[model samples]
Target: MMASSDPAVIQTRALSKRYRTVAALTDCTITVPEGRISALIGPNGAGKTTLLRLLAGLARPTGGDIAVLGTAPRPDPAFLAGIGFLAQEIPLYRRMSAADHIRIGAHLNARWDGTSVRQRLEGLGIPLGQAVGTLSGGQRAQLALALTLAKRPRLLLLDEPVAALDPLARRQFLAHLAEAAAGGGLTVLLSSHLLSDLERICDHLVLLAGSRVQLCGDVDALLAEHQILVGPRKDTTAIERDHTLVHAVRTPRQTTLLIRRNGPVIDPAFETADVSLEELVLGYMGQHADGPSPAHLSAIGGDQ
Candidate 1:
């Protein structure tokens, strides 16, 4: 459960992971507050999977430190039980029936809620006699989620859990996820490239690019601090003096500027529009593409 002190549920300082010659993650650091749904996003080959694996204690870091639920990532059974992970593949025994899976879950988890799991599967119209191999992709994903939630974990880690589901299925999955979190103090860290679903469910955001954390903070606060200015194509000398320009694109007639506003935008020539979560994420990613790696940013790990 979340404490009144508001301690960060997950924290990493200079955390790094390497596989032979490849550095999957480099000097990464971020903080996730308890009970918030945080979206971890990045392009392909951006180390998103590697970071999730590290958090799950499936792999050890080559350097730095990471603490989840106030302890370092480890293979301890008790620590593992406190975390419920649903991998992207949605691994399940193809030969087993849905009832068999439920039985297995109850046998493995100390806090498994059999009644809740049974009710969830039944409500979704997943037959207890149906073989896992015969279930649809969406049904399989739902089943995986049901099993995880039944464990009543404090922290839930989902890696692209909805990437394979259809729009309707995605909606249903997120709705169920929201209810689960609201029912208890569940902290979630979900990685996905689907920004649409993320914006609908996540209250916090973490952007990773070039094997580093590009941005991390409360979603609303981050949005409030960023704005996209559209105006005539001209020198941005005046605007640059007041705001941090994240990215800028200019055409013959118009200019679009993605800036982090430090104060009010008093300029009348420029029409400012609220930046959506997608735009904000893309802007940061664009900046990453144009600028140096996050290693150059001295305060990369600090509060945004």
Candidate 2:
């Protein structure tokens, strides 16, 4: 059994899931530390949904182990109360009013905050008397989030929560999410393809590509460890020996490399530039592009 006091709110060891003959997630291992927003990113069909569903206790893994909030994901009411999940569809009863949904949520959650939920809807100008089906996309999104927040969960799992919202609506929703996370004792794991938005709100990142965990770590720490070096075009044999190269490009006049450096650089010919979150994610995604899959590195080693 994993320790209750383990800093990671979620942990998986060699976790995998298969849909018939197709493997959705393979040999996956990762950790999502507590009290911070962690973004799960990957390209289409990269198993982001499968991983999130497993964590949400909606699906069972075919192999390996997973623990949510220190216990195995379970369907028991006591266990379910600790987690709140919002899927990409954001399902709500079409004929129900905002008040009706609030009442239903109060009955369903042991720690439901009805008053707070009502205030959030009202503050957002979501009418209590209007049927949900009549609400705008942005309004419905707000309503879905409010309901989830009212559950007062220990960990919130969001699957592309803002994928359909407009720019202004997306900002508003994230602002509310940030405020809720700031209020202590709540941890969030959200998956999205929007790298720019993730950079704005997420403190930690887990990047999956080809159904594998390519990178996972604190956003700041990972960025600091990986650097982009620009220098004159030369043989990369020596640098490749020390640094784990992710991606490299060269022209007749210059060369630039995205590398995971374990030590201080003493090379006089190269100038190191900071790597952005998008660059880091893309570098890992491109790891398998040019040749056979690169052997996995222990840059930010997984829980396994």
Candidate 3:
């Protein structure tokens, strides 16, 4: 892999994949800026994992292109060294201690930092002598993360790293990851069904649906461009036509609308309500949630 000075750590163009009659991804394009956490979200089978695997070099795209750190996901040792991935399913050695698995990371990774790993593990208070198979689900997840972080990869590809963690653990893990992104210039692409979990940490959000990107942008800026208003049901028709209705609820005499519009404070018919990041993401995925439920809510090891 050839290194460049560009800050764009991950970039893709028209990326797609298909399996027989199923189209898993179609014309997917996204850019993850350097030094920030980017959340890749979508409804079940919206191609979140498919796109992630393409970037991680674990699976080949059926069509289209992908580049990590300005080079194709080829078998370049240098390129591989620049990235560390924690799969949705735990990938640690079942018989090994947390410490042993970390040793593997040190042996295999080009940029592995022993001191960093020790410090992080010590900070987390993860017992190193126990076998990974014996630990609880959340502990195992932290062990997996420890192995990845010890490598000190420039680009971190995590597929729901915190899904199995408890609320406190989840918060702690993401807080550290966010700090790493802020201080180490680490670029992360994480996919999860829990939008609220990422709300406070991630800088950018990407929503995928129907095998394509529905929206992608800075979280704060994106919300600013969209607003929610609630008022008499009589205003529904006008609100739907003039602004994008992300989601809406109707009561006997009042209707609530989450619209993508900005400008002026001059709406006498409806009252505006600020939407949280969770509401914003749920708004986009709500359209597809009615079809077959969501494949996203299923945990990583369910029925495995």
Candidate 4:
């Protein structure tokens, strides 16, 4: 478990990114502490990729600031050596064999650990002599991950790395990731739409909707701060005055409200229940479908 006092490995303030007429991200701010695997999730066109690109220093932000490893990202050798980024496409030479790629990595990366990475691939029964193009999708993904891990970066940023893998492959990929993270000294920011998979390996969360941050916090802290309230259908003016209403659904006789507690719900009218991570994420995403108000867009915990 990561403690609250852990130093931040990633921070952004009022970050904005625009591509011609479209705004990819707007006034986004977030913080990720060291030694955490954070899930970055949002709907399509919500700027998840843009954020990852900016953090990796592949693209510059149009406005605001971003810091990774306590300094602004740059293309210098030291900065590049400290972080490993695997884009969604999983860039690799299709014509090259796994052994050929390993040799290339050894020459290109100063900290390359080809021996360990090759051993890992061999243990998985991934043939070293086979051309990468002929390998299965899972094999290619694993190969890419192994190469990235070979660099031994302190921070790893992945953009939908496993979206194309089947269920068993995804499970295997996540298991490998979990094993790597268990060694400590590594921080990962993974962008994926699979909420259940994220829940299994991530302890931190950064949720984006409407091209802005909707929620950002430690998983346990966020869950502890939110709850579901069920009661008879009626005007919620009084309730609204006290809590941050994340989502509300009303039926003929009853109303269910998911809320971020401003304080304890002492009102006898509502019965409280625990909120699951999937339910919490869905509520925030649904609430922001029509554009979230300023009041609802605040970061839940950590630096804003």
The prediction achieving the highest TM-score against the true structure is 4
Candidate 1 Cα lDDT to native? 0.85
Q: Which parts of model 3 are misplaced by more than 4 Å?
A: 1-6, 235-241, 262-267, 290-304
TM-score of model 1 vs. true structure: 0.91
lDDT (0 to 1) per candidate: 0.85, 0.85, 0.75, 0.88
Q: How big is the positional error of residue 240 in model 2, measured in Å on the Cα after superposition?
A: 1.2
Question: Over the stretch 158-180, how does candidate 2's per-residue lDDT look in tens digits?
Answer: 98888899999999999999999
Candidate 1 lDDT, 34-122, residue by residue in tens? 98899999887788888888898988999999999989879987898889888889999998988899999988877788788789888
Listed in order, each prediction's TM-score against the native is 0.91, 0.93, 0.84, 0.95
Worst 10 residues of 1 by lDDT: 295-304
On TM-score, the stronger of 2 and 3 is 2
How well is each residue in 209-247 modelled by candidate 3, as lDDT tens digits? 777776676677777877878788775655554555566
Q: Clashing residue pairs, candidate 4?
A: none
lDDT of 4 by residue, 1-304 (tens): 3248989999999999999999999999889999999999998788999999999999999999999998898988888888989999988999999999999989888888999788989999999999999999999999999988889999999999889899898999989888988999999999987677678999999998768888888999999989999999888878876887888889999999989888889878899999999999999888878455554554222223
Please report how far candidate 1 places residue 175 from its true position, in Å.
1.4
Candidate that beats the other on lDDT, 1 or 3, i.e. the better one: 1
| TM-score between candidate 4 and the true structure | 0.95
Question: lDDT for model 4, on a 0 to 1 scale?
Answer: 0.88
